[model samples]
Target chain A: MIPIVSDLAPLVCGLLLAVTGAGKLFGRRTAQLAANTVLVRVLNDGRRAGLALRAVGAAELAVAAALLAVPGTLLPGVATAVLGAGFTGYLGYARATAPESSCGCSAKAEGPIGVRSFARAGLVLLGGAAAATATDPWWTEAARRPGWSAAFAVAAALLLCAVSADLDHVWLLPLRRLRIRLFGNPLAGAADGPVPVAASVELLEQSVAWQAASPIVRSALLDHWDDEGWRVLRFAGVYEQAARGARPVNVLFALDLGASIDTTSSPAVRVSVIDDDTDEMVPVDLLAGMATRQVLPMAT
Target chain B: MSHRQNDPGRRGLDRRRFLTTAALGGATIVGASALGGLDADAAFAAPMPSLDPAISRSAFAEGRITQIKGSVLEVAGSHGDQHLIQLTNATSIWKLRTTTADQIQVGDGLYARGVDMPDGTIAADAVWVNIVNLYCTVKGIAKDRLHLAHGAQDHAVVGHIVADTTTASYLGGALTSDLSRVRIGQSAQILGAWRPADDAIDIARVTVGH
Candidate 1:
């Protein structure tokens, strides 16, 4: 069993690596993130990035196919090991330079795209290739070895399909559940008491054009809430309309009023009063339409 | 490990010389005979199919053409898994049920049985192309070939128009006169079969060209 698994493991690793390569070529977000690592950043432009990924994917698939088709040969085993070592070298380089930087691998999800994973994949491939080359003869006592090898290869191919999709979320869900169980709350930072009333608010869409009027006006807007004893939150919402443009295209800024706000409902307005201890919309003396456009900074 | 490091030549002479002598003796014996068994094995290096073609043929006969997409045919049987058979200028053509190579098209389902080629593909002798109708647009046109792009990934189907049946109706529009008559931006709904190969589409239709 050990020999069988050892002989088959590299083939399995090669198959998985090929799938990963294909996924990267197809612009999978995870695959893209992986490519975005510092080493890949050396390649300029998105087109080049895609081409590099496709070339790598094709090479990986070819190697895997070769390993399977031409077994009992020392040449393929050595070739696979060389490829693995090259991958490991790249991983090491990435670790040395950008240890904390996000791995912009094509996968949209954030995960540890670290050197360890690459080293693991490489070593597995090398081991399998070596074992396959040095396996027992055809007339060994285990007459069923050939059948078993064929079966394992088929299984590896099927698994390769799943790996290609980058849908390993199914496998990682249990890990997430365990982490959540160990940790009391995942989101401790945002769990503060009732949010303070915003110092000032503006229609974010119009704020852009309004800010262009003067740099001073923009600076004033950013600084106004800092002077006031209130915290501001930038809110954004999307709404579905029965008829197009029926929804109100406006945002209301409530001053320092301790108020309840519904974060979930889109297109629903929440009322808050500045410097007031109630949920009511407090009246303010207008400094023209610009005062209404004044926005409070969250840091303040 | 230390033995090899210390005195490798002694062991090498024993194993290597003995094997070489045995191989030479076997080669001489087979070289001197008309039956020509073991020498042929040394020369060939790889095992060919069994001497009895009937046994190999019987094993190959079990695969059915599971799906067709353009020039690529998918055969599933004896192998117990779908194997893609790529057809090109070099592929030997065959007919279904001993009929001449007619009645073949994209989407024509088939059951093909043949010998497993040394390269691990089936060399089908009998191909039963299943005929199924497909509606797609002319994604691209190359000389005598039309490329139909379809489905989520927008797979491309490439094929030349069947002789004489050149006119085709596109997207519920009137049938155009011929493949040449259809414009680049025109939509086409073709009644034909599709054969799926590796990332390819093979279309065979009775009516095309819109």
Candidate 2:
């Protein structure tokens, strides 16, 4: 039973390596990963990085093929151990030096290096070491005793899937979604009432006043406040027509909440340019004539 | 806030339904009002144009240049898709600056946005070479480089400051090529060209302060 379990480790690792290697070799993402990630910096240049990735991929495929076909070969087991160790070391280096870099272990796996990546690498290393002690191939051992061997293989694969953060969408996310559906999403009732600031901001963005003032506005959403039944949204803008040449001013839009009207369609939104230098409000009628224009002019 | 606001019940209608109805009705009212002096009959009779959903509006592609044959560039996408990009006189190619087409090299990461041609080639109007805009936090500062934590995951990023190109914008102010003011733990937005194959980026501009 010990030998059978040990042999099964190499089999699982071999399959995992084969998938990962195939992704590196044939997948379109390999080029980007090689070029954009830390591989280039560590490996010297882009061309070298590409070559290195391909070589690793090729080596992995060869080892996987050897392990799967030869079965009881000690050479493949030793090679697997070395490869796993190398992966662990490299991942560690990447994590410490370039945490922003993607692992590039698999095609679909594109995220910053994290603990799960470290775990996955460590798992491979452990599997390789365990396989080195096996007397016979897992398949042959399983053929002799079917029940426990099958169970071990299934358990090992499931464990690998669980540790692989890249494969989470496959098994984990769906389970989470189902659970949410049954129990209801916790955030569903978070927003009860009283118009959110985001909603107010969205309404401001869609307003005609915003369109007219956007060109002069240099800064985004400087400050916002509610005053006299109106939500005032302020932005930093250049007041070009100032007496003392062009100067920065606070552009405020007063949207009436009392009207209970969609500000997007409402023509009553008032605009004011406040000069900080003099503390004076300059009312602007930039969008005054816009309301009388033709509406819903062909969707094209 | 009043309980009436909390209850979300207005004029005997549910909150969601009321909001939806008000939005739609307001839009209709606005449209009618925008018709100038046009009568209601003319406003209702106006023809509404149909939008074609099948139209492909894909204007951006990011990947490495695999093959460059004449004015055509064969790009291998980050995903398992291949893209052919055509360069014209109007197509502006930028590496670190406003450069010509000759600067574009194979194995260089790029982002091109333009009209997708009928023959599946993208007629690129603009191509930014190795450009990356990152919202990062200053984790540490060294003599030569600044260690940054970028994205929601706080991924480590090394930013190399170019003497000529690297500039800083403080508190929505004008850009200045001074690094002395930059401090640790400050959140910064950096625009720079990514060094191919490296986790490091050459900083062009750093904007600090919200």
Candidate 3:
């Protein structure tokens, strides 16, 4: 997973740092721009928030550009990593003590950029520093075989690593976009992309099991049931069909059997849509028996 | 605190996340310090490890080829360190500690271990090539025909000529043929890379998502 993130880290960090640096070098409106975002509302006053935000953005943008341009040689990597370490440390300290904050850096960006928003940038800077500073074993290889053949082989290997890193982002994301454009995915924009019942049934429900994953994943699963769409009606420990043909509505939040509903009495769930004319409780069991499934993809 | 008093979102960035990132970054720098030096002038070179028969023989363990398909071969053994090994048929197999066959096929991704046979022949013992998993992107597709773009280092990937029943969609359209279904945009976690001969790759399994 870390390696996977590393692939995108360079691109995102480089872009962020370059943009941030440019903002600082040029004008103060970057802060003003951040202040206008809804996500930044969590920070209280947008104008004042904008100041810190602008500094951060400018710093990040510079780091990002440096990361890409700087070859992962020993000296350059160490230098860049040092800068990254210091910057991230400062961000960490600020976050730790601050009362409440929005990651004004990407407050306006779409969908799940985790604390990685900062850490990934930091890692790339550091990793690049490490790669740059570390000695290429090829030198030794060539030393053993004093010929152009040895030289060519080492050159090819180094070139491969560099090119792979450069193309990382487009390799995954652009191709996805291209596939979508050329093929026209019917499942486009659907929650979890039209999951088949067989696949959805495989969702791991045990809390202990789920908690083994990264904290970010666990927290997302716990807090955002609205976005998760599918709810756990009842864990019941084992997969028992309430009825053979009854298709359960895949929801994220599980309902406690006796606490939320009477097993024998009252229809399982009561759905009441508030409209101008009607307000009534629809039986949960009735919907559970319905065959068509509705789900919302969990997006943070 | 001053920034916090004015902009509350600044407070939301957790210290834990920041510290973890910072510490990791710091560690990477510290670690790189010990990994030797890289001279930029000599950056482009292939790393040729010094091969000492005595020491190197100990590093490679004996295993048997349990299965063979294409570019992928499966070998089973208790060797703990090596989880996956990728090799071609042109690999020299003559150290007579183990020998299963005189020559493995082109489609065979073999697993064999023996002393570097003086005659370049690994003696009779064990040989295995375990089926491997490849994560790749579908570069092009035809019904039962798939072209994949995969590989790191050399970017060597295989194209699988198999069609899966799962309806894969990319962008906005529903693909009809295997060719139509696979667009240049989607990525897949493929199971096998069946290289019958030459540089061709045949995919075994294609997994997009659950």
Query: Best candidate per DockQ, number?
Result: 2
Q: After superposition, how far is residue B173 of candidate 1 from its true place, in Å?
A: 53
TM-score of chain A of 2: 0.79
What are the per-candidate TM-scores when only chain A is compared? 0.47, 0.79, 0.31
Model 3: CA > 4 A from native: A1-16, A23-29, A36-45, A57-79, A86-112, A115-119, A124-174, A177-300, B1-210
Best by lDDT: 2
Candidate structures ordered by lDDT, highest first: 2, 1, 3
lDDT of 3 at A45: 80
Interface RMSD of each: 41.7, 18.4, 24.1
lDDT (Cα atoms) of all candidates against the true structure = 0.39, 0.64, 0.35
Taking the tens digit of each residue's C-alpha lDDT, what string does model 2 give over B50-103? Answer: 121111243567789998997888999899788898875435455654456777
**Candidate closest to the true structure, highest TM-score:** 2
What local lDDT does model 2 show for residue B21? 29
User: What fraction of the reference interface contacts is present in each model, in order?
Assistant: 0.00, 0.02, 0.01
Comparing only chain B with the true structure, the TM-scores of all models are 0.33, 0.66, 0.33
Model 1: per-residue Cα lDDT at residue B172: 35
Query: Residue-wise lDDT of candidate 3 within A100-133, one digit each (tens)?
Result: 2323333232112235446544554555554344
What docking grade does candidate 2 earn? incorrect
Whose TM-score is higher: candidate 1's or candidate 2's? 2
